[model samples]
Target: MPAVVVTNHGGDVPDFEGKITIYVIICVFIAAFGGLMFGYDIGISGGVTSMDDFLKKFFMNVYEKKKHVHENNYCKYNDALLQLFTSSLYIAALLASFVASRLCTKMGRKPTMQIASIFFMVGVGLQAGGINIVMIVCGRIMLGIGVGFANQAVPLFLSELAPAKMRGALNICFQLFITIGILAAGIINYFTSKVHPHGWRISLGLAIVPAVILLIGSFAICETPTSLIERKNLDEGKATLKKIRGTEDVIPEFESIVAASEMARQVKNPFSKLMKPSSRPPLIIAILLQVFQQFTGINAIMFYAPVLFQTVGFGSNASLLSTVITGLVNVFSTLVSIYTVDWAGRRILLLEACVQMFLTQTVVGLILLIDLKTTGSLNHVEAVIVVVLVCIFVMGFAWSWGPLGWLIPSETFPLETRTAGFAFAVSSNMLFTFIIAQAFLSMLCHMRAGIFFFFAAWILVMGLFTLFFVPETKGVPIDSMVEKVWKQHWFWKRYMVDADDEEIKEQVHPHVK
Candidate 1:
């Protein structure tokens, strides 16, 4: 038998046992499949749109019919239409995320995740079989809705279920799966694109496999104890907590959860409370971090990497291959975040990543701009340089903003406003994702290298934002985050108070002080 472990939660409670750790890990993996599906849908479209057969089936006629009038105009118009097709999912996802907030609260986390899986299955079916633009559009919308629900609910589910010490790494696991999904889609696209006429269908349909896995896995995972308690099922909540913690001495944790839920219930209007003076700081932090994450040009690079590579002198096959490299770098680099997030802290990683990203984006823009101004085409060396710069930029993102952006909001809000706060934060992310996805190609068409410069400027702004405002949430207990961190009047002063420091804790809570 394994030795009983203990936690310091004001009393001696058994620490998570081996069996419970296994159960929690299994649940997290199942929930994270939602992220895998999210990445597959996002990455699949990029490759699918690049496929010759896909283009011929959907876009060739438009180009052919209008080619006589002006070839460039027709091509531009078709590109715009394609952009709209790609962005449709994001728009639907934004709307679905808000709905998921209510659904997750009402139905509980497990059921809400199952709902997303169902949407993903239907959406993947339509897209795979889609013969017309209308069918594809409808499919994208369904997938978008699924993405929204999964994005909002998965992180929240993982956070609630995970222990504070491992919470950052587990939440980052959500992003890790996303990168894996992207890499998988890229590999699938690379192979399928070689098959010609029906390859795009295979790429689009492959997403269904993960969606099916998620649907089945959803049945096995337990409901979050916090959600159960909030619904007033105290007995069931305690039972679930025992299962999750793998120990019968779950009284302390259960009582803590009950207290938090009761406090949340006291606030009749969570939304209005969110807008109050006391709640504004954390809410602002959540919203702005999400905004900066999107505005940093990560999605633009993700969605159109193949096309961007082709523009800089690579052939279609090579462009697709290069996209695989981007996906690989993304996956490997996120590992850095998973390992360091707990050790190095959030604020430092984010600040450093922003600086590196700023430099990389600037270098990419300068190289592209100089190429346009001088040779009008990149030499082999310059092309390599551009690719190298892009890889570095992606590395900076994978370890920092990419994971922290999701992790922070999940940690910031009090339980009272957590669901609503997450809804708003995720909706913000999706909304910007839509704007960036819709605008990327058009901006590239007109601005060329200037688009990279635009991204560089935003990255600089993000670095400053981090330096001044973003709090370091290394080992802070979730229960005390709102009272200790968010309610602090000064940004610099926020870090002065540590949740674990008894003296500092006393200062924050006057009665204790």
Candidate 2:
């Protein structure tokens, strides 16, 4: 007989074993289309906004400002409406995430992703066919809602389906696909920028590709076994668990899930339960990760990559090309995370990235502060150096904050509050992303090169936060996270009530009095 492994939480903590079955692989890849769709919009908007034709059609004032030889290098593209085009999606995403949380717990992750795709495709149609700014912004709002739904569901879905041993790697696929989508958009933006009057339209229309893929994939994949079991579909959940685990002998795993679901049933309102002392650690960490992740100023750089490149001295074509290079770096660095996350543990990567990102951002800021000014651009060599520095910063973020921001929160919450808690995570990310996206250009206009220092300081805080508060969760099983992780952490442990834990232990692993 196989060894019956147990955890700090006893019988409910047994790690479910599973092969890396083809079915699971396909499902992971499909669900990750949500990330692809999100990244596409992020990359596309930046490049599209920089296009002359695009600006002429939708933002003529910014386009005219770009032509003036005397325009402040830092302030050329800081129009409110131009910023709105990129940022409106995130505010909409923020509102949608709460609704998405309801769908994730009540309707299922599979259906939530399907709904996301439908809305995203419609958004794509509107932006591509936009006759005026109103149509485009409305489309962006639609896209935001789609993003909110997808971001909320996909990470939780991946974590639930994956085995503990391989969870990090599988879950990182969502971020991997996101990086790939950004790279794809960068490439699309490059060629289409040459297509004249309607090139921007082509760029905007192609957002439909990833959305369509997600819509189709949603139909193909099954609802997660955990979701099904939680909803009281025991037989179907059992069948899915067998399929996903690639085994008929799943008795221990099924019992563990059923027991957890039984406990989940006792908590009628998951959000209210999140307020209890036991739930505070994950909730606090989840929101702060999203906040720090945004404050890293990664999106400010990403959302205006082409515009930023131009501000430093690159011509239009060269700026788009530079954005593509950074996109490549982002995608490849995320792969580094995929390989190392399960091995290095979360804290190591995150802490190491903090130092790297801090130094790079600081140096970049200092360089621009000294060499470039509000009136003129960087010298060609200096401009190249800035691009290289930005690439390093992107690399640091991609491998650490980018993926872990999603991965950690998804894994930390117990099944009882998983979707609801993750919704807060999703909305937190969207809320700050909206703030950064909306205000970044204006901040850039005022802060000039000092903006980089602002982010570097935040990176320092991120490192300190991770060093003291974040616990390593390299291979912990999902069901026993509170006991093995939160209950063991030096700080979080204080908030954990042993009596409540004892009660749960008694239920999952009963003993004769």
Candidate 3:
């Protein structure tokens, strides 16, 4: 038998049986495939748009504009329809999350993920084979709906299944897989760009691989004991809890989950309860983190790195290669987060990254503002410098805001409002992601190099927000965050007092220390 490990966070939260079991590892890696699908789309979309063959076939006007030797460096890829191809999925994701939240609540996280995979596979087919703009855009919309479901379910699934002691490292696997997917897309797009007239097809078609993996993987992993227990499958839930914990003595943990689920069943409407005082801390923090994550302009850079390289004077192949370098940086830096997030804690990494990103963003802005002219591109040396600086910025983001943005919210919400509150977080992320993906090229056209400073300013604000508003959530059990984290937070605690606490107090020993 595997050794039973019990860790206590000052006795404020429950100590449950936890071990690094192979069964749990396999389940998490499988669920994390959803992130791979998402990341591939993000990384591939920009590179595909930059492909000559891809543009010539679907967006001829933009392709012609790119061929002009005298085109303004900042405005070459500023077509609205082209931006729509990249951003339409996010808008779809935003709307689909509400429906996904319902499905996650009524069905289970596993089913929602399976649904997401099916939708993404269809999207991959439509996008790869699309001859018309309508087919491509419609495919993107389907992909968006799929992303909506996956994003809504995956993080919450990981958090619920993960041991509180190992939660940060495990939950972050979703982001780690996302970074790997981005890296894979970059490598594929680099080789595929060499193929004439159909390379983009291959890039878009490959999205189906991860989608298929996620679909098959979803069936193999057990439904989270939290979800199963909440859905009233008590016997299986306990058996699962025992298996995942690597121990037969899971009575305490199982009973705790059951108690929480019973309280959740009392609340007929979680969204309504989510607006009440007790829910404010998680709701506010979750939404703001998502909005701020996008405003950091991480997605802006990820979505258009290749285009930005081209604007800065790298040739087509060189631009694609540079994007690949940054993709590599993004993937490796995320590994740092996985190893250190549990040990080093969340705020320190986040604060350190804000400073690093601020300096890099500002320096890149200055370099572009000085060397990159409106009518002409940066010189070769300066262009190389710009890519290096952007790599530094990407490193800071991939390790810090990128993973924690999802990790924090997924762990913060109480069971009664967990899925519903997480839906709000997902919608907020998708909404801002859409805004950034859609407007970034036009914003570049208008703001020129000043766009970097704009994002840098937002990074500064994110640092301040983290300093004061965000509470440390290192070892608190997901089930006890209300009592152990939010209610204890200096600024957030005021929102904790209300009828909800008293009601929970009266009913059971759950929801508080």
Across residues 1-513, which tens digit of lDDT does each residue of candidate 2 receive?
Answer: 232222233444665667778888899999999999999998999999999999999889999999999999999998999989999999999999999999988989999999999999999999999999999999999999999999999999999998787789999999999899998999999999999999999999999999999998778898999899999999999999889888777788888789889988877899998987888999999999999999999999888999999999999999999999999999999999999998789999999999999999999999999988888888999999999999999999999999999999999998888888998999999999999998999999999889999999999998999999999987888887887889878999988885387578768877722
User: In model 3, how large is the Cα lDDT of residue 156?
Assistant: 94
Q: What is the lDDT of residue 182 in candidate 1?
A: 90
Candidate 3 residue 344 C-alpha distance from true site, Å: 1.0
Candidate 1 residue-wise lDDT, 1-513, digit = tens: 343343324232233331337788899999999999988877778878777788889888543633343333212333667887789998999899889988888888888899999998999899999999999999999999999999889999988887766778888989999999999998998999899689999999999988899899989999999999999999999898888777777776687789889978866677776775556667888899889999889998888887677667676688789889999999999999999997799998999999889999998989887774412347888888888889999999999999999999998787888888898888889889999988887787678688899999999998988888887776655666755455453663443344236435545884742
What TM-score, computed on C-alpha atoms, does each candidate reach? Answer: 0.90, 0.95, 0.97
What residue runs in model 3 are displaced by over 4 Å at the alpha carbon? 1-4, 499-513
Residue 506 lDDT in candidate 3: 61
The digit string of per-residue lDDT tens for model 3 on 297-386 reads: 899989998999999989899999999999999999999999999879999999999999999999999998888887778888898889
Candidate 2 scores a C-alpha RMSD against the true structure in Å of 3.5
Instruction: Candidate 1: give the clashing pairs.
Output: 5-15
Candidate number of the best TM-score:
3
Please say which candidate is ahead in lDDT: 1 or 2.
2
Badly placed stretches (over 4 Å) of model 1 are 1-20, 61-78, 373-376, 492-513
